[model samples]
Target: MTDDVRNIVLGVIAAGVSATLGWFTRSYLWRRRLRRKQAFFGLPENSECLLVVNRDPGTDGAVHRHDVFALLELSSIVKDCSAHVQILSHDVGRQGYGEHAEFCVGGPGSNRRTAAHLATLLPGVRINTDPEPGEDRAAFQLGSDRYRLETGVAEYVLLARLTGSQDSRPVFLFCGQRAIANQAATRYLARNHEKLARRHRTHSFVLLLKVVNSQAYGPDVVEVIGDVTRTAQTPPPAPDPETD
Candidate 1:
């Protein structure tokens, strides 16, 4: 081949090779991200997932506004992984935990499904649904530490990924002291799922999150209090004999 022709052909071949490598790299990265999300969420690609809803008490078929936002955020996540979202209200919801990936939202005060999860899965955690006068209602008691609610100033919520002993699917729990806190938890999950996946890939965990300035930020301002996985999952210590 002529010198100029050979040079042109070699340059074209190099460009083709570079393009092929770039496409492969992009494909690999996309697949990796998808896998990590699937693991974090316990929902395989193109699977049927359940969204257990918690309706507000004393309301006739009405969902809290913040809870609705929370569900919408979670729905985007489910959509990202190509999973179908089938919603069931806490009143009539009946299904096995491990059969499909599930996301349960709202606190026990309104969500009996969440109450059941705390009862069966998280034995150490206790939520005060009702309190007499001069006491803080909707407080959380995990072991000895008590998280009190203060309206818009401060609120606490729980986000947990729980898997049954014999089941591989994980059920995500979003229990909050208030409706806004529940939305905050879901926002945190949506933003930090990749980081969470890296640390606890497919493993169960529980987190305590604080919502700050909800009156101003509307679930946008949040901070992590700590990981309550160990304390929440473990049963509380028996009453001390000395105290008794």
Candidate 2:
């Protein structure tokens, strides 16, 4: 080959080798950074948790309220452990009303801890829905109040009965929809009923509420119950004697 041709071939080969090395170096650094971050967060090297939130299906715009509950649940699970966690929220209907609202009302600080912990484990959390704004405050207020008055208190009483035993786990509260008209009743139900049950010193029950439509609500609630029950089966960490 002529001198010029040889020079051109050498340059091309050099460029290809340089590109390959750069790519490998970048991949290694990226992985190392990820490992360091995970270590700092104290996340388990390879386990995962699933977090879900329910959302209103009616609206076309804005972050749906259901996400609030999902985030809270995610936060709670991750508090002080390291595990890969996946957060999911179930979306049902246009009204944008469902179980998540109930979940959001209580335990704000504890919820945040769950979310922070999960963030360390998962790549990222997300909601599954298309955005749409629905009904005005008046409608939500009316519905919320009525639901509360009608079943809110009664529901809580039942929950308390179920959870008040010594066998009870920590009850994570969840709701299917906001009972605007029945706010007092609902709040009373959630607090009083659950509280009374807890006093029994039986089982610990963590109540999780997800807002859902009338037709499908029962099944959805059952599903959440199943998950909580399963989680409860996992032996809790030994209590710190110092704290006790």
Which prediction has the highest TM-score against the true structure? 1
Which parts of model 1 are misplaced by more than 4 Å? 131-134, 240-244
lDDT of 2 by residue, 1-244 (tens): 9999999999999999999999999999987654543332223455443343433334442334334533543354344344555543333212211211112221111233222222222112111112233322111111112212123222211111122223221223332233221122233333344343334333333333332332434212221221233232334345678853
TM-score of each prediction: 0.93, 0.28
lDDT of 1: 0.90
Error of 2 at 200 (Å): 42
Candidate 2: list runs displaced more than 4 Å: 50-244
Positional deviation of 159 in candidate 1, in angstroms?
0.6
TM-score of 2: 0.28
Task: List model 1 lDDT by residue over 1-244, tens digit each.
Answer: 9999999999999999999999999999999899889867877888988898998875886999999999999999999998898999997786668888989999998988899999899999999988353456898999889999988989999999999864568889999998899999999999999889888877889999999988888899998999999999999878778853
Residue 195 of model 2, lDDT score: 41
